[model samples]
Each structure stands twice: as structure tokens, then as C-alpha cells.
Target chain A: MFNAIVSAGTLGTALDSVSVLVEECKIHLNDDGIAIRAVDPANVGMVDLTLSEAAFESYEADGGVIGVNLSRLQDIAGMASSDDLVHLELDEETRKLHISIDGLEYTLALIDPDSIRQEPDIPDLDLPATIVLEGRDIDRAVTAADMVSDHIALGVNEDDEQFYVDAEGDTDDVHFELDRDDLIDLTAGPAHSLYSLDYLKDMNKAIPSNAEVTLDLGEEFPVKFHFDIAEAEGSVTFMLAPRIQSD
Target chain B: MFNAIVSAGTLGTALDSVSVLVEECKIHLNDDGIAIRAVDPANVGMVDLTLSEAAFESYEADGGVIGVNLSRLQDIAGMASSDDLVHLELDEETRKLHISIDGLEYTLALIDPDSIRQEPDIPDLDLPATIVLEGRDIDRAVTAADMVSDHIALGVNEDDEQFYVDAEGDTDDVHFELDRDDLIDLTAGPAHSLYSLDYLKDMNKAIPSNAEVTLDLGEEFPVKFHFDIAEAEGSVTFMLAPRIQSD
Candidate 1:
């Protein structure tokens, strides 16, 4: 059995982060907290998220896995205000998740865990470049790039210790560069990669504008974006494969 | 030659009002003001709008008729903010309208006034019921009705001096009533007419929420909606043919 009360904003953000990659996921509820790891059907992107017990107003569990429809949960969460407290309860007999917010009760039928795809194993890699900055800066750069092309190149200038995003169209191009002074932190290294803007646009919505987003980069390799939520009580990491640049 | 500087909001509202009925129109520019009267292609609805010279920040014009594509003008207006000042100029030699807003100049090709539909004569009707209320209240009623049915019945209760809007769906219905206290002014008469919600929804966008909307109604007759713009310096009137009630 499991029950918890959490801020609507935190749950909504967490669901959004996972929903961008997969429609359904298996959320593991344990004494430690709740966690989900899933990958997109195209195998081009992956998301892993965890929320500690401290993130919730109240949490109790005996450790079990619950299959959830992230899209349905997101729809219910959309009705709640940011400050509203959401009550969650599991009905073992009916295998449904009950969510209550602002006097509205939504009962969602749980998906069968056996029907969902197995979670992807997180890989280990030595990424040479690391940059941390405000999420809004990256969001703005991606939005500007969308006006020009379908793909964007992210690169670090080792000599100048600057990070830049560039997108070139048939006749127009957009470029945005940020020096060390504009970033929260930077570990300069020679790194560059091209990624599809379609995934980045959806991921941007899940991230808060003011929060710090740490990016790990390598040449033509998958990129990792990590950020904290629920006042550091939760963390979300997204990895997206680079698109082959056809010159 | 015609040149004027008007608030983007006023121009946007004016364009929106006419665009609902016709894509292109003949704008009558006079020493006193500018006006346009056009009917929808289906001839089911008509819009009449006037903006006095006092509505513009600066006005200078010799009387002339200029053809305008309201859809194209609305697209240019979309680039401006509500408070921004939009400069409009006519190039007599090129027969084009130049709209300048936020450092961007959009030159629109004008159609010959001779090719456009002639303005319809406004029909004079002695409607008995006249109810004046906030535009938002009626807009909300229309929106609610849209969810239940495609047509809405607007009438006044002669006995209670109350104005009401009613809509019925296959299995559900919605009704909203307002007494004299809820309206700015109410002249109750035995009035009832059914109107298409599709037209009302589009027309609602042109009416400001806080502005007073005067509704003129008669049993099974065309309905008239009139509202002011540019702080009473301009006015817009919409007349829609009543839908024949099938019961």
C-alpha cells in the first residue's frame, strides 16, 4: 500500500519530464522515494527522474511498482494550480490511482506493468565538457533556432571558454553564444554535437526557467541534461542522441 | 493621400470586427472619420464599423475610398502590442497600404475597390427589446452554449424584466439569466431569437470585455449587437440573421 501528498507543481513537472519520452511508465514506490526511468519509442531519447520522500508533504509505502499513464496524470494535473496540494492514494483492490486536488477527485485505471517496455539501462561515459546555466537561456536559444532550422548545434569554445548554439537554414542562420560570465559554471573542453529541435522543444516545457540546468557534452555523442526540482529533493536527467550531420 | 497614427489596439479591434464577415472591404475615408460596412459571403451576417478622427493620435486625409484586405491587415496588427502606436500610410502611386509597427514596415497590396462587393444598405428596424450589459458576460454565455449546442436562444422575460440565454444539446442544456440589477440597462420586451453560436464566438474576440454591449432583439427577427471602441470615439455594429427554430 502507498499514499502521499505532494505539491501539484512538483508532481506535474516530474510527470511532464517523463511524458516527453514515454506515454506510460512504471513508477517504483519504495521506502526511499519514487523513481521512473524510460526511453522514447524511437530510442533517440531517455529520461530518469527521482523524488525523495522529503519532496512530499507526507509519504508512506511498502515498496511496490505501479504502472501509470503519464498522459492521463498530466491531464489531471493541468487542472490544479501551482500551489495546490495533491493527494495520492493507491487502491490495491481495484488497481487504480486516486488523485484529489481542490475538491476534485480523479480515479485513473492503472496500466499493467507487464505491458510496458523494459526500462533502459543508464550508460556511463566520459563527457569532456560540462556547462551549467539558467534554463531560460537555453530555452530562448532553442526557440530562436526553431525559426531557422529543424536541428541545432551545441558546442563549447575551449579557448574562449564559451558555449554556443547555432542553427543554419537555407538562407538564414541564428547563433547565440554565452561566455563564462553569463553561465553559472563551466568546465571547458573541445566538444560539439547536433541534436533535433523537436525533442528539445518538448523537454524545455518540463524545466523551470529559473532553475539551473547542467549540460554534459561530447563530440557527436549523446548529451545529458540534469536539473533539480522540489527544492533539490528531486532530480531529473534527460539524454538525447545526436543527429548525424549530413554536409 | 491618407496618413494616420492610431493605437494598435483600436486598429486591431476594427480589423477583427470586419474580418469576421469579409476578407476584403472598401474603407471609406472622409474628413470626419473612416468607416467600413460589409456582409459575409453567405449574406447571413453583416458588420458596420466607424473610427472617428479623434480616435487617431494624428490624422490627415483627403476623402478617398481605399480597398483593404482585412485579413492581411490583421496579420500585420498581430505583430504589434495593444499599446503600440501603428502608423498607416497610403501610397497613391503604388496603390498600397504601408503599416509600420515596432520598426517593421509591412507593405500590403491593395485590391481595386471596384472588384470588391458593394456595401449593403443598413436596414432600419423597430426592435422593442434593448439590453445593455458587459460584453464579457454575454461572451461567457455564448462560450458556454457552444459546448452544448450550435445555436443559442436569447430572449427577455417580460414578466420579470430579466434577460436570458438558453441552449439545449442532445442530452444537456444550459441557461443563464440576468435581472435588471445585473445589467447596465434593460428595456424588457417580448423578444426571443435563436442565433448561430459560431458567428458569435468569432465576433466576441473583437468586443472588449469591459465595454458595454447593447443588444437589440425582436421575436424571430435579426439581432443586433453594438459596442464602442477607442473610448467611444469609434463604434462597431453586428447584425446576424436569426436561425429558423426547428422543433
Candidate 2:
């Protein structure tokens, strides 16, 4: 059970609209240190992530069966290169992790096994507002919001057939909406909530720009995104804590 | 008129870098519908690149003059998102180039580009032996090659201070040297060549584990990377045509 605020920061950069799913993710022990194995499948979009042996030089693993640090493992996964020396190791006594590649001879420690925690269990939500839109549309709306503001407001009107994402900080407050009919589905009963720009930015990496994405949303509950990674069917869901408004 | 290649065949992936010198580049119209942007400042490293935008949508340039087919543009810049769009116009015939934040958008037309006409040309390099490595490694020998293959060599010499990248095919053979000293320098040479795998992967985006990066070379000719792209830079020295293969 491991959860982390691991962000690939893929949105606005290259990946958008689609969903990423890690079907089988785990932390194991190896001769070197703790090893992490995640089969993440997402569309082969415009971005190709790679890493050199040196970039993953520093690793840490302990225990008879080393513990896995999901975030650090994700970091190393994010830097994978085609020609990289890709290998993972686990510890035996402390249950920590270690990572290394063939290029860099020395194996580096990744992180403390204790730092990684499980994703906060999401309460069963009977959401008041939900909408289904093309992964590409949300990607576009993010672009529009990017034009001026970083803060995005997610809301729904009781009678309206769509959901909206509006960024008011910029002069051109981008209003992105997918009408009920336009969306695969919509259950709008009235809701409102907001989040900062960063969480969305980080969340983008986990989501693809092509899948038909579903928004499991409510006024302030963690916005849930459901989509597929690639040929390997998987999902990367992030629940960002709401940004309490100061004003 | 200057001719360079920047398309799906040659410049095979995303082409941008921050740590290196190549900050900006331009492209324009030619009979073949391509222009060259040389890095006279030796700040350019994207030549013969190749990458593709797997899933892209269509959009018109807002209030811009240059009207180009969206799909055609992908052959040049791969996928783009409006959120990352920068309204760049060249004179009245304007064009909008959406790029990653780390990317510098340089738009130029082939009205009359700076010329590069070598008297004898850079001598038709007779590329001999060549081989295919990971397209991502052309820039990341620092850890994968440098730190590991401190000594560079083509044939198996247990005690040679080097390893070479070779690709032998119907066309030219590509070769790259990675000696301990050479690797030491090449790591730093990223500046001299203004090349960074991190950035190249960002702009032209190629395959990580799938795409095979081909290398070509001779005893004394500059190493040539055979990639696929639909465009090229200009007459400036943004790209380096090997002078001679020597330490």
C-alpha cells in the first residue's frame, strides 16, 4: 500500500487528454536494494521519457526485503532512456530500496522506505456533479486556462448539462465546458470547488491527452480522473486537496 | 538558398535543450517545403532528427497569416497544445508555434536565408561501418557510455580506452567514439555541440526502447547520425559537420 504526490508534470508539456494506468505496481527486494516494478501503459504520444545511468546514481534500500519508495521510483522511471542501464534492487534487513543502471557502475540509493505512504482512501462519494468528456477537450481547456490563470474552478449548475473549468486570473478567463449531450455522461446538480495550478500540472502527467476521460467530481472532494495508459490498460488517479481560498 | 532537414525522417524527436547552447532556430519555405537554421553560435544540435506526434488534433492559427495544414506542421514540430501556444508572427505572414515551456519558438520564412555553400562541400564523407543504438544515447554517454564504457573501441579490445557506436547498412556507416578522455570531453562537449539528449527527446521526440538510433562513420570523417525528419536548419553553424575524426 503506497501512495505519493508523484507527478510527471506531463500536461502543457506533451502528454494530455489520455489516462495512465499502472496495472501491477510493487516494491521488491533484490541483490542491490529495493526494486520497484510498475507496468505503466500510456499512448505513445509526443513525449518519450528517458534516463542515463548517472541520473539514477543515488539509491537507498534496506531490510531483508527492502521497502519501496514509489515517488523516487517514479522519478527514476520518468528519466528512463532507450539506451539506459535499467535495473532495480531491494534490501533485506531494513525493507528499503536501491536503483542502478548499467551505464553508471555504482548503484545509488533511492529513498527511505518510510517516506512512501498509501494513497488516502477515498470516501465513497455520491458526487453531485460529474461529466464525461474527451481527454483531448480537457487538454484543450487546460491550454485555455493556461492562457491567463493558474487557478481553475470546477463547478456545475443544477440544471446545466455540462461541467466547466474556468481560470479567472488572466484577462482571458478560459471557460471550458462539455455539455451533457456533448459529454459521454453528466450528472450536474450544483457544485463548486477550486485548486491551484501546480496540482493540475502534476496530475497531467498521470493522465493522457487522448482517452475519453471521466471526471469523478464534487464541490471540493479530490477530483478523480479515470482513463487508460496505453495498450497496457491501467489508471493513474490523483486526489488533490482543495486550495482553501484566502479571500 | 540554404537547405537543411527538420522533419519526421531526420530530426526524429523533439528538439530543444536548456543546458546546451542552442537556444532558438528558424525554418521557412523551400521548393521541398523546408528551410535550414544553422547555429553559427554553435548553439544548435538538431540535424537529421526524426519524431512523430502520435495523436494530434486540428486547429487554425488565431488571427495569423500563414495558413498551413495542421498535419503538415506535425512533420516539422510534432504535437502541440494551445495551452503552450505562443502567438509568434513573422511580419504580415504570421504563424503560431505551440511549444513546450522549455522550447524556444523561432519562426522564419525562406524569403532569402543565409547561405552555406562549401566549395568542395564538407567532402562526401565515406561512412564505413555503422550500427544501431538507442536513439536516446546519442547525447547521454555521460552515464550509460561515459561512466560505463570509459574506454571507447569498435572491435573487442579488453584494454582499449574507448568504445565506438557503429551502424552498417546500405547507406553510410555511423560511428561514435567514447574514450575515457573522449567521454570526459564529450560530457562537456554537450556545450561545444550544444547537444543534450534531454532536450532532443523533448522537441522531436523519438522512440525510447523501440526506435533504433543509427550511427555512421569512417576513420577520419565526422560521425553522421542517420535519422528521419521533414526539415532542416539554415546556413549558420548551428549544427556541426564533423571536420575530422580525431582526438
Best by DockQ: 1
The RMSD (Cα, Å) of candidate 1 is 8.9
Task: List model 2 lDDT by residue over B1-247, tens digit each.
Answer: 2222222222223333211323333343333333333232442243432122221121222221132332334434544332333323234433343332226554534222223321122334445534455545544432232322222223211255344443222311223454544332221111111123333333323323333444444443344444432222211111233332234
Report the Cα lDDT for residue A165, model 1.
Answer: 86
Model 2, position A171, has a per-residue lDDT of 51
Per-residue lDDT of candidate 1, residues B66-89 (tens digit) = 988776677667656799898888
Q: How do the residues A35-69 of candidate 2 rate in per-residue lDDT, one tens digit apiece?
A: 33222232111111212112333333332323333
- How far residue B93's Cα lies from its native spot in candidate 1, in Å, is 31
Interface RMSD of each: 9.1, 13.7
RMSD of each: 8.9, 16.0
| Per-residue C-alpha lDDT of model 1 across residues A33-147, encoded as one tens digit per residue | 9999998998888899999999999999878999998988988888888889999999999999999997899999999998998999878768999999999887777766675
